[model samples]
Target chain A: MPVHPGEIPKPNTAWIWKTFWIITAITALEFAIAFVMPSSTLRNSIFIILTIFKAFFIVAEFMHLKHETKGLIWTILIPMGLLIWLLVALITEGNAIHEAIF
Target chain B: MSTISPTTQAISDSALDKPRTGTWDGGNEPFNASYGKLMMWFFLLSDAFTFAAFLTTYGLIRHRYQPYTGTPEAFEFSTAYWPIPEKVFNAFPGLHGFDLPLAFVALMTMILIFSSVTMVLAVEAGQRFDKKDVQKWLLWTILFGVIFVSCQAWEWSHFITGTDEGTLMNDGTRFFGANLAVNQYGPVLFADLFFFITGFHGTHVFSGICLLIYCFIATTNGTFEKRGHYEMVEKIGLYWHFVDLVWVFVFTFFYLV
Candidate 1:
């Protein structure tokens, strides 16, 4: 059979193996931060950072966003980006409610 | 050796050479689905909002408890106040006699995380059209999801049972122990937030378990293999992973913080 000219190679088996390794490493790092770090702003910062990294790996590789089109990634990521704004607005509203009751 | 006709060859070549689209979708335009892959993206987007709302509410309640803020033990739930998380959620396994903080919840978190690995393997098997492997992975995934849900249920039972015999005061109304009544835990609001946040996330885990069961059934039936793609597994995997992701935040905001 004739081959396609521009088509990318089908992702190899190694992709799954590599994905596992990355996820394992990120999870280990998260455990370390949670267990070893003394409570502080620094520990919190590290925890959040590692969490974001773990999330990124799952989204990019296991979810195959890296293989997706720009339109798809944006469709997914833009809303997540908006969550920051959502958090601020919701938290502010929640605070107001707390004030009224308190 | 040039045995195939030119038009037939051209059609085959075109099928092979088609430029890949930019989207993560499976590119099956005829069915109006790029494949179920893109569904994961959208699902995650919606899920993120749900979790964000819960965590933000938690923050608001915690911030209100600021001044004269006491240590974990000081925030104990008497007939008058709400208990602190470090105090409430620190149940260790039997025989430890030591109060380890966030122990069971931490273990639950690991269970969900490991379940995610099994889900990915299921997806990988689906891609290869390996029915046996798919069945194995999906079974393991379902088992793990069920275990995670059971753990959550146990925690909820403990939370609801409270220290005393399930009677608590809240804003002058007598509420049951299962609820976040006033004086059951420092502020009436703490139990309110805890129930709402963890409850919603637990519901998600429940649904994820259902989804996993369905996936397992479908895998055993060889549906995806017949469809010639395993995108469904990947799509559901996104939902499973998102459930785990939300737990991370819940653990941070509810337990650790």
Candidate 2:
């Protein structure tokens, strides 16, 4: 069935365009940090900050979870949460293997 | 239960039926998704986990070797220590004079990111039933994807056989200096990690290229036009964006960190 104007909600294209521009700017900042920053501490902080920003835009906008139902948001979020756990667990395992190899 | 019972109900039923024959109604079920869109989301979800695992593993390994490999490039630290990412990834095609540092990989990253943008634009155009825009943007996307894959293959070959003459480690060990193995550039374990992390990512790029081909064919055949929608564009957009997202992580963990 075709979606009626009343049935399906429309997303704000202006907001999407704004978010896209912001991400592009953030990417430029990230490149600067990677190449020009003299202080490693400052560069590391900037890199992590920009990375989180990019991830936020990806999950909220590109994935369309921002406008989705709570159930759908939870569906994607729960797996993402699990991935955090998996990263910690598996990477620790990889480290142990590295130790054994060394 | 009120006085206006069966007769009132009959009136409301007919009233609701009035719009049923319109173009917007006509037996169409709300929220019915195309297979491609659904599958794309599922694939991206799984791919996200795979990439997260790789980066996390890199983190763990780096941390475990902290004090030894940390401050790898510090001026006080011996030149014999610091791992130079630029030196490792430098690959120029049939050129002399100028030595490029990660230029090829950086270009590949840009291509994938731009293709992702084009893909989203294609989806937008698809929604508006703009077949010409969809075709144009998708062609650009396919071209970028193919170029990215080719560059990756060149990089892989460079890493495997390597360029210039170098000695093999007596024990078949591989390192980063005069010896075919083990000199500067952190623990030898990093080479293994490099191969695994990038090989897995290359596989994703390869599959994405295949999906783009399928999308290109479907668009050429007027499939989306006949369906009166652009669900396929949305599906491919998900896959394309996921590829870009993974690269963001790879760039940080592999290069910056």
Candidate 3:
């Protein structure tokens, strides 16, 4: 194929492998924490935070979203704010329903 | 196509007459990404919301019950209480009868993470125009995806079959596994959400595998070479990464949490 100067992504193999290790380590940390820390609200919250951290890497490094323009990045992220609202609002309603049932 | 520079192809001839500062006015590649790639990103964002809706529903349903407050060792599966994830997904292949909570799903997570790594490598190779490496990485990615789906199938079967220590229900019959009707582990909704959520993600993985196969075959036959770019491979890579990303959330909410 002739080189016509297509958008060439930064072809850094080291970063890919580095990302793999970082993701794997976070998952390993998650699994270890599960065994030692008994199930509780705090433990579940920690799990959610770690999961978000891992998600950032998968999107940023693997999907190449990090290198995308900030405009593009915010374009995707800003709407997620509404999703957070959805989670909070519905979960609270669910708790109210639970109070009625029990 | 080969004669025209990528920049020329990206921006139309009329746009060249206009000022570069007026990005929105004409075709000055503002994001520096192709139209196809941008569409894929938008599509994935919509798909993310779909998954979010499913998960949010699960959270709402889960909160409707009083979560079992007992210690993990003393916990008993019942319809009256929310099930602990580790208590439900404990069995591992060839190592049954042992309580290795969260272990098997962890292995599944590792497999998915590795597959994402292979996907990015394929994208890298595509950018470099290394035909052989692109094909190699795509094949590896497809292989891992198949393995991941197979693991999910096995996990589903284990979930449906349940264990010998089935929970005794209110009626006196011992319910063993899970189905649309009842899960011995917890409320019927627990089993319902598990099937709906994980099954949906599994379908995405299955479709991703099919897309990868087509992408792989296209790469081998020199389709991309003639087209002068491997943007198709890059787009598919984005889809594959999104699948892996969804699994990360699924793993957190369904298994470890």
Candidate 4:
């Protein structure tokens, strides 16, 4: 398993290009929505969803999280899942508080 | 031979020196990842939470100030105290008379994402031990990062200087520029959150650029060549991608939402 100096490892370049295009396309869609779509609940939801989708590609492909072992991936993703839950709960609670006081 | 007790013999065999095997063995990386990579993932996970917390607070405060209900059209013209994101962020650089809402920030987002692509390409080149390609892509990524930061500076200056000599509120207060106290944009909290969230993300981008520069230098000096792997490039690539990932969320929460 020893490596020699200046030895170039063969890499799969196809995935890189595919991911690049996918990210670019998603971003283009986001920009389109921003301009054409009016500000509304549905628009906000779409923005959130698309943002998460873009995040997934960056993490999975660029960061190589998808190539990691399940244990490692879960170690990262599980906490993020909990964080999302926390976000939902807090925002809901914040709304309730706002309604009660104001 | 002197009487060697079992406990003494076991003590003499250092645990660190022992050959590890099975589930408890160090040989079995639970996630089949290197130590550095695993640590980076953990760090990013925590950082994500920090950003989520900030955005969540922003949502809470925004909802409190501007409670929109019923039809979207009604809410759009509801005359809420909170500022509309598009209205506040409508300015484009050097386009004084034109109102290009979100166009410039959108361009900034594209630049950051494109930089992320270059970072990935750099990592790919590193995998192949293509020093020249790695350096090339890294430089490109750095250049993009610099451009994004400069664009941000211009945006901030424009925001601070105030358009149309600031907004005159019904409360008989003339609001101008942004600070911890007041902002001409709208509610004070909006400007505060905007500065804090984007400022934090900007710091990350700055540091990511610094890391890329260091990697570029090391690559030129044949450091990774001697190591026989471009793991350093991959590690920095993870960080660079995380920065871009955070910005995606920031863009959604701050600008688009």
Candidate 5:
């Protein structure tokens, strides 16, 4: 097939609008949860989980990572996944330090 | 070799004669991604770790100073050595004495997120080779980015000027707005970390806006159209979204949690 110069490819507008709404909805939910829910471990966990959900959508859909090849996807996701372990270890160490101090 | 069939010998011969174009030949995309996109991903990955370290340190120090009570509500309302985030961040611009906790930050968050949406739309326009649409969306994204930065500046100024003069401490001394040495808000470290973390993220936002402006000019000048692709817009879209992604985590760690 011959290609024409300066021709733009067709875009998926529906998908874009859908993703926009999804992100907006999650943000609204986050704000609502923050206002009404009492600050607790559970509330904190909810916030973290919601944040991850929003991050996933923004990365996958908006950043177009969802359409990338498996190898490329793993290249980015695997290293970021390890950061969770870092979070756990550091926070635990922080707790130990807190206990040791006044 | 003596045991090999004629077809097997032909197959082995062809394999041996095949061109040895190693992975570095630049012909093959091992991960099915272009060099620019792949490099951007790697940069973002490392950058993500930097932010993770900052937030984790924030958690470590904050937990040490946080006052705990049996009741969950008490934690939010606690007057412990650690400052309550809700209390410290509870002021809106032009709404004096309103006591609207997290309202301004929430507005800022929404603005950033909305900008992300516009960025994606711009990328979509780029995909269709719609130069005008791309310019329009990019302009909107840049406008929102500038608004977010201005709001941040206002918030910082309000913070530095010391609300209500100063909060009295136990030693009969009054501390004013945040500085490296002292702050009226909880521990001095709290103010330091807040400035460092948010300031770093805000800088990214500023840079992202600058990049968008360059892309905007390039688009108007027919750079992408001449090249027959809009990969530049797509690449920058990845960065714009990454900025938004980091803000989501920052909002969680600094504002909501």
Candidate 6:
């Protein structure tokens, strides 16, 4: 694609280290919140949100998905979207079962 | 066979020599990526679904119980409430008395992330056709990976060894450590997910290490040089990064949250 076959375009290496530091910082922040925050729905939700934020950086930056073609990006992400449905449905079912029993 | 005209014969011959434009997905490489690269993405995508299913089931089973809110001192393994993960995972290796919980797991997360960084650096070196650099970074990546797996082994062993105090079951017997049938933890299901999810991820990390060793050997053998590219490194890097990505989630769901 870079005027010859098998040619990989050289991207900035700085980006890699940058992403690493960002991830490390985010992880440190997660640790800080975990130690201080009381166990509550809001705290758990924040953890999940931060986890997603970390995931975005990994998928989009480290995996190079953001720089890829739109079609390619969609191909990878669209199928993953269905996982939300499975999670939601199963969680509801699990909660129901718990109520039924106790 | 001799019935074809000369002009028609020329057209057919050229067609055989060169594929017509726009024939394969509007002419350009599909998604502007190679067949192997595209396939890797799809494979990772499927693999993501598999991990998602496992973790989603964990979430489902976890939500079945009311959350544990007991103080650290009051905590004990029982089916009446879920055990706070930190309390269960508190003991650090070597030091017996330290009630450190998420500290070691956090270290594992950092190690895995650092290895991923090394792997991406290898990919960058590969793109630059710097085989020596590629090999160097790859060795680092593999080293970190092995270290990560070793740390996990320790973590799993510590988990299996459990606490010296152990837990007294409702029955007269005492429960120590965990296995398929018995878990000293709150619910048997928690230990099941712990072993299954973390074990599966560990297996992936091991596989990625093996793949890196292969790449290292190939780089030494001038394999990528002969092929005029180093896309293989990129492919394996994708896999290594995915392993790290999965760990990110596992750390949150299993340990932190």
Clashing pairs in 4: none
Docking class of 3: medium
Q: Fraction of true inter-chain Cα contacts (below 8 Å) kept per model?
A: 0.27, 0.26, 0.79, 0.71, 0.75, 0.69
Please report how far candidate 4 places residue A100 from its true position, in Å.
2.7
DockQ of candidate 6 is 0.52
Tell the DockQ for candidate 1. Answer: 0.26
DockQ (C-alpha based) per candidate is 0.26, 0.26, 0.61, 0.56, 0.52, 0.52
Q: Candidate 3: which stretches are off by over 4 Å?
A: A1-11, B3-26
Per-residue lDDT of model 2, residues A1-102, tens digit only = 234333433333575567677777776676666666553657776787787788778667775657656655676679887877776686677668657755
DockQ leader:
3
Tell me the tens digit of each residue's lDDT in model 2 across B71-189.
Answer: 32542212233355655666777764355766666667677777777777677767766667778888888888888888888776666655453334446654334223443334565
TM-score for the A chain of candidate 6: 0.85
Per-residue alpha-carbon lDDT of model 5 for A1-102, expressed as tens digits? 113546656666788778778877888898899888877899999999989999999999999899999988888889989989988988898788888886
Worst 10 residues of 6 chain B by lDDT: B17-26
| Candidate 4 residue spans exceeding 4 A from truth | A1-12, B1-25, B67-80, B170-173
Backbone clashes in model 2, listed as residue pairs = A1-B28, A1-B29, B174-B181, B175-B181, B175-B182
DockQ of candidate model 2: 0.26
In angstroms, the error of model 4 at B213 is 1.1
Off by over 4 Å in 1: A1-40, A89-102, B1-35, B67-84, B93-97, B164-178
lDDT of 5 by residue, B1-257 (tens): 12457887788679775546677764577788888999999999999999999999998888777555444334332225676677778899888887788889989998999999899999888877788899999999999999999999998887777777577776888767777777777777888998899899999999999999999999999888777778899999999999999999999999888
lDDT of 3 by residue, B15-43 (tens): 66444556576657757878899999999
Tell me the interface RMSD of every candidate, in Å.
5.6, 6.0, 2.5, 4.6, 5.1, 4.6
Task: Arrange candidates by TM-score, descending.
Answer: 3, 6, 5, 4, 1, 2
lDDT of 2: 0.67
lDDT of 2 at B159: 67
> Candidate 6 chain A: minimum summed lDDT over ten consecutive residues — where?
A1-10
